[model samples]
Target: MIANPSDVRNLLESHYFLFAFLSSLGTLQIAVTGSGIRALWLTPYRRVTRWLGFVCIITGVLFFFGQPLFVDGPWAAGSVQADSTTRAWGVASWDELAGARNVNDIHGGLDGVDQAIWFSLAAIIAFSVSVVFGALSIKANTKELRVDAKLDDDDIDGLAGLVHRSYFSNLPISVRNFRLEARKFWRDGVRSADRWSLIKIISGGSNQ
Candidate 1:
């Protein structure tokens, strides 16, 4: 339950809190399942997870904006002029309880509605931006992994050479010479048949 809901700030805060909780759950679900969208079972619904994330954000915004309208209406508030029947049941209407205690609070000095509206907009914008970036990252990573998986030994060696040139360009000559000598020594040691066989065994039989 929320305390001081008569204050629109508290009410909006409660709505925002609930939105955060539900959005977190939605994000977690997307994280767990988004990568598997290409799998056999999930391939059919590949776009669904992405759309669901958008829906969660939009729903949260709607809930935030709709609360004020609903709370002010007479049907939602019930009658202040209750008759004998209403009292006979011992049930209190919304007006009998709080009577819209701060009826003008939402429109008054603090700019509470404006603050909540802006906050909800910011939250939605942040969520949308994060989702877009996350999706792009997932796509880039997946493409990179696929390219790496398709690379042969020559391609890998060429990449290693490129890396060595770029990374060691500013190194001292002595340091580069020492690294080359150490690599040569290791390669020479591993060239022995017995040592090579042992290395193959240790490396799960992969000669590379």
Candidate 2:
């Protein structure tokens, strides 16, 4: 059986709707997933992804623009399309088709929309993958910070000489002597009288 012009129009309309739905899905994913990933990366791939999605949406819109399937018109394909150009801007009549047609008669040709689909598809896919990477990146960062904190604690402990690297024959004796001297420094008898009264207390100011 031969395909009626109306049937052909319907088919195009179906395809346009499907593409529109897919384009919307991709755009949504790019936004949600890319934003999720954005929290982790010092740098995000969003600029490129945004540009790509914009291109896809524009391309899909232009492709279905005032075509027989998308607009309200006498043609069979009219009114079947998803008027998706950020504000219903596309071919809505046969006369508009003249402008949509380009180069060898392609509707969504060279002007960015045609080139924008692949970019959009890739960007959306990349963003989906990035969501997982972001979570892993955060977990790894937390673990690293933990390790750093533990190492710092260990270093501080060592500086206080709680752990000795080597044992010299007289080391313990020296350490004991050092401790004794330190304790003596804190004792009242060890501190010289001249060192006292140098600090003026707020309440003692009048007496001074």
TM-scores, all candidates, are: 0.29, 0.29
For model 2, give the 10-residue run with minimal summed lDDT: 161-170
Q: For model 2, how does the per-residue alpha-carbon lDDT over 94-207 read when each residue is reduced to its tens digit?
A: 654543323211222233553466456644655444444434443444544345443234223212321111112123545676777678877855455434444634445333
TM-score of 2: 0.29
Give the candidate number with the greatest lDDT: 1
Evaluate candidate 1 by giving its C-alpha RMSD to the native, one decimal: 18.4
Cα lDDT tens digits for candidate 1, 30-86: 653455422111112436655666676567666544444455322133432432122
lDDT of 1 at 169: 24
Ten consecutive residues with minimal summed lDDT in candidate 1?
Answer: 161-170
Clashing pairs in 2: 66-91, 66-92, 68-77, 68-78, 69-77, 69-81, 70-81, 71-79
- Superpose all Cα atoms of candidate 2 onto the true structure and report the RMSD in Å to 1 decimal: 20.2
Clashing pairs in 1: none
